[model samples]
Target: MKDLYARHRAVLPDWLALYYDEPIELTHGEGRHVWDAAGRRYLDFFGGILTTMTAHALPDVTKAVAEQAGRIIHSSTLYLNRPMVDLAERIAALSGIPDARVFFTTSGTEANDTALLLATAHRRSNQILAMRNSYHGRSFTTVGITGNQSWSPTSLSPLQTLYVHGGVRSRGPYAALDDAEFTAACVADLRDMLGQSRGGVAALIAEPVQGVGGFTSPPDGLYAAFREVLAEHGILWIADEVQTGWGRTGDHFWGWQAHAAAGPPDLLTFAKGIGNGMSIGGVVGRAEIMNSLDANSISTFGGSPVTMAAGLANLSYLLEHDLQGNARRVGGLLIERLRAICAQLPVVREVRGRGLMIGIELVRPGTDEAYPQAAAAVLEAAREGGLLIGKGGGHSTSVLRVAPPLSLTVAEAEEGAAILERALRSV
Candidate 1:
């Protein structure tokens, strides 16, 4: 492991971060558990950064990928493809957008980049509004829109992005306010920002829950209130559901539905769990907006048959198994258990999130100061206890992230929670 880690550091970019002081190379996974190279098994709580939407080594998705690969795999968008169209049809129907059109991509970054392209072309403006402490992706355009300075690599961008408030509910200028007042204050801030900006702003792209910002989100209907203001100015709404889509949030099929008073957003970008780690992603939007571009565009590897097959099988399994309902039932228990455990611990500042996606924010014993070191220690401790987890935050990584596969069982949830309790206590 040490030799491989040294080789990785020598070959990979410095920015490609790895977890733990002594990184473990994962050998394989099954269900919600994974084995490292040394044959140590662990209950996987992070789900490969929430990309494994269903289960690891799911037979349905694996068989589909194998079968599809055996037949054909390299055909691009120039030719008609059945699996791509099939998955697109399913997603378009599920997407809540009227007259929806789907454009496939290889990652969340490309999907979001496509969304930005469509919005800018449709509205003829390069100005965009993004939430504070939000993370989009790694692309230049995404980096510019991302409000989290830690993840963003550069300030150079093609679009003029305006950072907005209301993404993080537990921390901010309006944190002290009640839910209703908080929502109103965020809406007022949005309206004021729009009022000050030049006319014809293209769109506002936001994550229903800020994933890389430690699973943080605004109060319910906050985006709906912001939607009202955006609609008055003809600005489009683009929901980035990369990490929160496909019922992971339990309460809703899509994270944006929590703010559904204004109906669905004009455009939606999704990736992560959809393909179950097969590298599938896409943007769905109204036809008018999607067709605004005058020139043609194509993705060489996006929507290939093999990946689309994996997506179809994975999605079918998720729905047929009622994994979303399972998440609600099991996740409720897990969160309650953690809250009770953390109530006595001063290092735990807060436990926030919904469904399978949960975050435990760490702070100094009696103060609000972010304790990133404690979060790192807890993560290492969790791994040592036969459980694997992740950490993230806007405050230099002070939040522990837990997002196992949607198919996680009650027993598994309880076990993971127990392991987490021990880890937290150790920290």
Candidate 2:
């Protein structure tokens, strides 16, 4: 293991960070559990950062991928692809955007890149609005719109990016405001930004629940409120659902449903969980905006037969079994249990997030300051107690994230919560 770690360090880029003080090489997984290279088992609460939506090694998805692989795999966009068409049709129907059209990509970065292209081309402007503490992706175009300074490596960008208020509900200047006032303040801020803009803003892209920003979220109607203003100015609203899509939130199939009052966004970008780790990402938008590109564009591996088959199977299983309902029941119990435990832990600041996407922010005892070291200590202790979770936040990376697969059993939720409780106590 030491030699393998040394080799990984030597070969991999330093920016690609691995978790834990002693990183474990995951060998195999089943359902909600995984075994490390040394054969130690753990309840997988993070699900590879919430990519495995249904479960690890799900039989349906596995069979689908294997069957497709046996037949054929690669087919570029120039050719006719049956599986891609089927999946695209399904996504378009699911997508709330009017006259929606789906375009496939292999990663969230490319998906957001496509959305930027559609928005800029449709609106004929390069100005963009993004929420504070929000993360889109790491690509050159996506990074420019990302609000998180930690994730964004460069300031040079083609677009004139404008930072907006309201992704973090519990911190910042609007933290003390009530939900109604907070929504109003953010909308007013947006109105003011639009009034001062030099060019027509192409779009306002946001995460319904900021994923890499530690699962932070605003009140339900914040975007609905923003939508009212954006529509008046012909600015498009894009929901980056890479982390918040596919019924993970339990209450809604898409995170945008929380703000359904104003109708769906003009564009919705999805990745992460849909392919169940098969590398599928795409954008769903109105046909007019999606077809705005005059020149041809194609993703070489975007909708490979194998990945599309996996995605179709995974999505079908999720809906047929009502994993969204499972998320609600099990996630509710888990959050209640964690909140009770956190109430007693002084170092734990707040427990937040909807359904399976949960976050526990650590802070200095009796103070509001972020306690990053406490978060690190808890992460190490959690691993020792035979559980795996993730950590992230816009402020100091002080939040512990717990987003298990949608099919997580109540028993598994209880077990993971118990282990996390012990880890926190030790911290």
Candidate 3:
């Protein structure tokens, strides 16, 4: 294995250092468990940073991909494809957006990049406002708008301005500010920024629930108020649902539905779970806004037949199995268990997030400062205990994010939580 790694490293580009490869070489996975080459089975609680909502090697999705591969693979985006059209229609219908326009991409970053471009093109503006600590994508433009400076070393273009806002857990009791006060303050800030930019603000991009920004859920009524402010400024609201979409959020098919009366975003970006590990992503937006782009404005491997087939099959499985309902049930159980465990542990600061996406924040015993080392120790201990998890956020090396596949069983959830509790105690 070491030799294989050395060989790959010799041939691969040095820039591929973004991921820290584990010692285990995973051979296969089923449900919520993955096996390494050594036949060691590990419970996967991280779910590829919330991408594997349907779990690995799902039989239905596998069958669909296999069948599609036996037939046609790629088709030019210039022509209409049945699978692409079907998946688009399904996404629109499920999202409650009538006559929504869709544009496909190969990954979440591309989906976000396309949404940003479309928003700017539709609004004819050069400035973008993003939530601080929010992560959009790694592309030049998306990274320019991403709120975390630690993730980027390149100098940002003057066209982008990020508003660093506090997350619910980070803001403590103040996290639940009154809707009117929160709205007024956020609107005033944006208004000032817009004035300084001479009305060049194109869009205000956010995550319905911040994924990498510590799995933070916004306060109640925040989304509606934020949307109103954006509407007042003629700016588009782009919801980056790359990590939150595809029924992972439980109550609704989309994470934005958790916002309730906050109203829908002008544009929504999705990817990750849509294809069940296959590369597929898309942007869904209001018809008028999506149609503003030229006929041939954007083109690439957007909606290939294979990816579309996988996406369609994945969606079908979600609906047929009622995975959204399962997410809610299992996620609620996990959260309740974690909160119960936290009640006895002073080091456990907070357990926040909704549906299948949850984060356990580890802080110092008597200080507000995050205890990143303790968090890492917890993760290391979990891994030693045969469970897998991941970390997130700008200030959250302290956050252990748990986003298991939606199909995870109650027993599996209990087992994972038990292991996690043991790990925390050991750490």
Candidate 4:
């Protein structure tokens, strides 16, 4: 493992961060458990950043991929692709947008990039609105819109970007406000920013539950309030559901459903979970906005047959098993358990998040100041106790993220929670 780690550092970009001081090379996985190079099994809570929606090495998805691979795999968009069209149709129907259309990409970054292009072209504007402490993706265009300074590497961007004030309600100017008051304040801020724009703004893109921003979320209906204002200015709303999509949030099938008064966003971006670890990402939007691009564009590897098959199979399993309910029940118990445990731990500043997408914010024992070291220490300790978790937040990265597979069993949840409790106590 040490030799492999040294080789990884030698070849990979230094910016591509790896977790842990002694990184473990995951060999294989089954259900909610993954085995490392040393054949040590550990509970997988992060789900490869929530990409494995159903479970690891799901039989249905694996069989679909194998069958698809045997039949055919690589076909460009020029030819008629049944699996791609089939998956797109399903997504369009599932998406609430009127006259919805679907376009596939290989990753969240590309999906967001395409959404930006569509928004800019449709609205005939280069200006965009994003939320502070939010992370969209790592592409040059996505990095530009990302409000998280830690993930954003450069100031240069093709479009004019404006940061908004709603994404985080726990640690912002509006933190103290009640839910209704917070919504009003954020809406006022959005309108104020719109007034200050030089030209027309194309769209306002946001993550429903700010994923890399420690699963932080604004009050429900906040986006709906902003939607009302954006509609007045003819600005489109884009919901970045890369992490919060497909019932992972438990309460809502799509994160935007929490703010359903506005019907739905003009555009929605999704990735990570739908394919259950297959590389599949896409934008679902109204036909008018999606068809705004006069010129042709295509993703060479997007919506490949194998990936689409995996997505179809995985999505079927997710829906058939009603993993959303599982997430809701299991996650509720897990969060409550952690909250009960953390009540005695002063280093835990807050336990926040919905469904399986939970975050534990670490702080100094006496101060509200973020204690990233404590988070790191807890993470290491969790691994030592045979559980794998993840961490992310603002610049400080002080939140411990726990988003296990949506199909997590109650027993597994209890086991993982006990381990996490021990780890936290140790830290």
Per-candidate count of clashing residue pairs (backbone under 3 Å): 0, 0, 0, 0
Spell out the clash pairs found in candidate 1: none
lDDT of model 2, residue 215: 91
Cα lDDT of model 1 by residue, 54-142, tens digit: 99999999999999999998799999999999999999999999899999999999999999999999999999999999999999999
lDDT of 2: 0.93
Instruction: Please list all clashing residue pairs in model 4, or write none if there are none.
Output: none
What does candidate 3's lDDT look like per residue over 1-427, in tens digits?
6876787778998666422344557799998999877788999998777777787899888999999989988876887789999998888877666668898999989999888878888888877888877888888888788776655557665456657353343563345557556555655665666667666578888887888877886665666766776677788888888988877878777777766586788899999988888999889989998889875664558888988998998899888999999999999999999899888888887898878889888888877678888888888788878898988756557788899999989999999999999999986
**What tens digits encode model 4's per-residue C-alpha lDDT throughout 237-329?**
999999999998889999999999988999999999999999999999999999889997877899898999999999999989999998899
Task: Give candidate 3's TM-score.
Answer: 0.93
Q: Whole-model Cα lDDT per candidate?
A: 0.94, 0.93, 0.80, 0.93
Scanning candidate 2 in windows of ten residues, the lowest lDDT window is 290-299
Residue 84 of model 4: what lDDT?
95
Of candidates 2 and 1, the better by lDDT? 1
**Cα displacement (Å) at residue 179, model 2:** 0.6
- For residue 386, model 1's alpha carbon misses the true position, in angstroms, by 0.8
lDDT score of model 4? Answer: 0.93
Count clashing pairs, candidate 3: 0
TM-score of each prediction = 0.99, 0.99, 0.93, 0.99
